[model samples]
Target chain A: MAKTLTIAPVSRLEGHAKVTINLDDAGNVADTFVNIVELRGFEKFCQGRPVEEMPRIVTSICGVCPWSHHLASAKAADGVFGVTPTPTGRKLRELCNSVAYTEEHILHFFFLAGADFVLGPGADYKTRNVIGVAAAVPEIGKKVVHNRHLGARILNIVSGKSIHPVTAVPGGFSKPLTDHERDMALKMASEILEFAKFSIAWAKESVFPKYLDAVKTVGVIKTGYMGTVRPDGTMDLYDGKIRLMKPDGSFVDFDDTKYADYISEKVLPWSYLKFPYAKSWNEGFDMDLDHPKGVYRTNTLARLNVCDKLSTPMAQKEFEAFRQAFGRPCHLTLLYHWARLVELLYNAEYAVQLLKDPEITGRETRVAVKPRAGRGVGHVEAPRGTLIHDYETDDKGLVTNANLIVGTTHNNAPINMAVKQAAKLLIKGGKYDEALLNTVEMAIRAYDPCFSCATHNLDGRLAVRIDIHRPDGAVETMAN
Target chain B: MTERSPIGLAVTSVHRDPAEERPEPEDFLDKEVLVIGCGNVMIGDDGLGPAFIKHLEARGGAPAHVGLLDAGTGVRTVLFGMVLAEKRPKRIVIVDAVDMGRAPGEVFEIDLAEVPPLKADDFSMHQLPTSNLLRELRDQCGVEVRVVAVQVAWLPDELRGGLSDSVAASLERARELVERLY
Candidate 1:
């Protein structure tokens, strides 16, 4: 086929995405792009509400990892309120955060990523997902389900609800946990440790090393990475100073107060979602497509790049080992999901320790919140990556405006460019098999974009779009 | 001493936030009657559950002694509330304002069997809550739970000002049902 093949609005995941494979006249590959098709005006929605209610309002953004946004928005609100929680408050926030990471990351790895590897890339797309894995490896499949259920249950215990929680508010939790709740959660999380360990090896040994040579040449976009920097200078998921590092692994001071300084976002004519790039350009496509310049990456890969250690022993060891092979800073996106598992493992381990600690039962249950009207910013790392809730408001606490940079926002440019790159690679075949398509799907998943979490509202007009360029002219195609 | 915990007389009539914003689980710990008012009280009728919780809270004079939990908007907290009960109750009266095509504030104490598990869950901090959790416990531990809800005039989002006079009057019926349940 002389024309580019496009499948817009990829089905079944979340939100909108269209996959396009560019083809030349001789039917050779040109480029591939998986265009994201949603925009979150959550930032605007958050403006003007009494800053006190910001946490609750923003927590509704994503059902998968509410704690991330809840904490991020709360911290931002804390910034506006000029109030930071006592150390205990920070710990509680971290506890809430750890539970979220364990649940969300586990689900993504096993349910989302498991299909491609266990089911085999060549398997039928329909049968190559969770269902296929369940049929092929019943025990491991059951274990994943069992562990996932336990993780969800733990979230239920800690925050009251598993999916979209409201437990970790601005000042502190509204209720104190009893010893029984703590004991039960600790026991359940401990059981999940074995399952999580099994999953990481499944990635590192079974998946990563096997596919290493293949993916090493793929997803080679080099851009600056961004994530929250801890006080200890390690990667922090719940709360920390924001760190923007160069592609060469050189790090600068981490600062949350000056977020607008290092990072930036751009909207492509092809995708509704905004692409976040480095304010300073290092390499890749001209970020300003019209003029094209900057290229920076954020989220999990960025977190991994910016961190030297994982807080948990097992994950930290794996981190050091992976870092050794991939070099000081890893550029491959295939390693992205694997890094997520590493984070998930540590989160599980940390959750067990925190729940086992007796002091948790006696932790101060609430923070006396004095909402003397001001703006606030909340920052927490979501499962996919770092999330920010920036709000500006008047003293009446009525929000003037709200801007949210979600897990996927940070990868907007790279994700789209990846699709284009892959399309350019696979454009030759007029007829494509499921395996090739799955590879295309995996390319998008590398970024782990949560489209549903980003797009708010029921405007059903959604599609995945790709632009195909021939030597003579360019054409656009779409699907829903 | 009694067959079931008499939760009604021990209730405090405090209206819960319609959004169920509390971080705690449902008053599942209470295990008797949970008066969940699904409205923002500052705006008016959403104050239904908290108003009742305050009444119940006042009854025992303290929250710890009186299991009158203000579930706020947290539906998931329902389990923790039920589990908190040493011995589950026979009937659980939930006083949330429902627009069931009835007179505003006309409180109805429908038996658990009669409420047909409309299964429409509270979107608070809970997921697949109420009936599902109750079933899990009953299947695992054999605890039977019930609910009592009142009909309101305005919609949940439409309850802008306060409870309609009719819904406000329903509080009396809810308060009365609490008296009878205990």
Candidate 2:
């Protein structure tokens, strides 16, 4: 008989994940999977819709990181519409991207991951949360609140709302900015800049080295890194080419527009998350390819590796420092948080520049868009990794086909591999405890995935719900 | 004024990322005051109290208390942050947009402890929900946090300076309370 410990979906953190450790005949730890059991089928439900609705429709993915999906989805739709965003549209889009980064990254580090660091992994699940952080590290907790609070406020001003902004339309914003909003954005950007810088220095001084030392040796090392880069060879979020750094720390043909030829997603039997492989290696590949196989990593660390240089000098320095430590293409997964803070710094600096820019407050927000028929691929560097959205539409502008390479899907392969490694590291049949749970959570946290969206649809209308089906076309379960 | 008592109004969006990444202070060593405020500025008059709180935090007049927190319309997570801190603050004041149905611009303080109970599905950040916080305070640190709220006039999605003329006029008064409270 196998004893299974169940952990339910908790607020804060990325998404709902369940861990069930399986025991062998002798009741030892034979195998375990930190299962993302809840089937969030945004793809299946999104079929046969207008390509224009893709951005707002997919905003139903997750409450915390909706803006990420919105941007990715919008770009995909924009691509289908066959329009290159004007410079103003691009700037506003980046501005919105900055807000999402500030809010999502800060929320994760402070409210979600803060528990493990401040309260220790041994803290009770109910008490070991953001509330616990406030009681335990009140001084720092306040700072965390101030930082995220300001970010949220800034998003509301620029995009009209923080989470599921309706401003970033197909070609551009719904309403152009007023002078007051722009001025307010600049002032708040200053505080947010301070907030981000404080975040980076604090992590370096207190958190990074400690976490790096502890979990650096936990997972099986894999070095293939990937992310998005601007055509001009700078870090980018809104529009850029996807770059994958090979294990040798060498660049593999920096690409823009030609994305479909390079990336492919596969599924492993162990975990529900999809495994993405480079198009070259995906052929003739089955689930388990034996030992010493190439492992592709998405999320912050991979993005850090692919960029020519960070958009901001401070982040570039940190990137250099990170590279200097373990050599280029760092393989350790636990260092994802460190990469995120570095990006946060760059984002803040960029936000300062965007906020202070006079162009952002312009009255011209829309780029005249026409519904000409063409297949377009919109790729943006989601906080997680290279998020690619491809749409094929008919002459009427309705989406005939759609494909999404979500950020979490890229992390699936590494997560499955890391789980086995982490399970083996801990002696099986040892009392089920916080240390073991932390080991599992930390492994997936390395991926830093944004799973799905949850919205109430406001206006007294019910938002979309998640539906998971089986191979036989029957509903496995419904999360309403 | 239709001010809510920082108890029930909540904000939700599926497009946002869940709290995968939390924020640490840019300068943890320099942080001092934490103010927890909530309300949607775009939603008519709901922006009242939280808007005032934002004004003060932006201007940097918060006392040398500890930190100013904008819990937003998501008090559940805000409470989570408050309870997680290892170094408990000397004081905490929760500001929000409430609907007391009073004349607009009439500022008043209400106790979160005295507020009505929220249901299981209720996810509002208006008033600091106490059930979870109370347990953590007593069991973990042996101290219950404090909360403050102001009356709300309207909660339409478009509250610029003209929409809430009362809140816009009484904004300074609300700032004064925060200043005094700190």
Candidate topping TM-score: 1
Stretches of candidate 1 off by over 4 Å are A38-40, A280-293, A429-431, A456-480, B1-182
TM-score of each predicted structure versus truth = 0.71, 0.69
Error of 1 at A2 (Å): 2.7
**True interface contacts reproduced by each model, as a fraction?**
0.02, 0.02
Across residues A307-337, which tens digit of lDDT does each residue of candidate 2 receive?
7678678778888888788566777777787
- Evaluated on CA atoms against the true complex, candidate 2 attains a DockQ of 0.04
Cα TM-score of candidate 1: 0.71
List candidate 2 segments past 4 Å from native.
A1-12, A25-28, A253-258, A268-272, A282-294, A428-432, A453-480, B1-182
**DockQ of all predictions against the true structure, Cα-based:** 0.05, 0.04
User: What lDDT does model 1 reach?
Assistant: 0.61
DockQ of 1: 0.05
Deviation in Å, model 2, residue A197 alpha carbon = 1.5
Instruction: Indicate which candidate wins on DockQ.
Output: 1
Total clashes for model 2 = 91
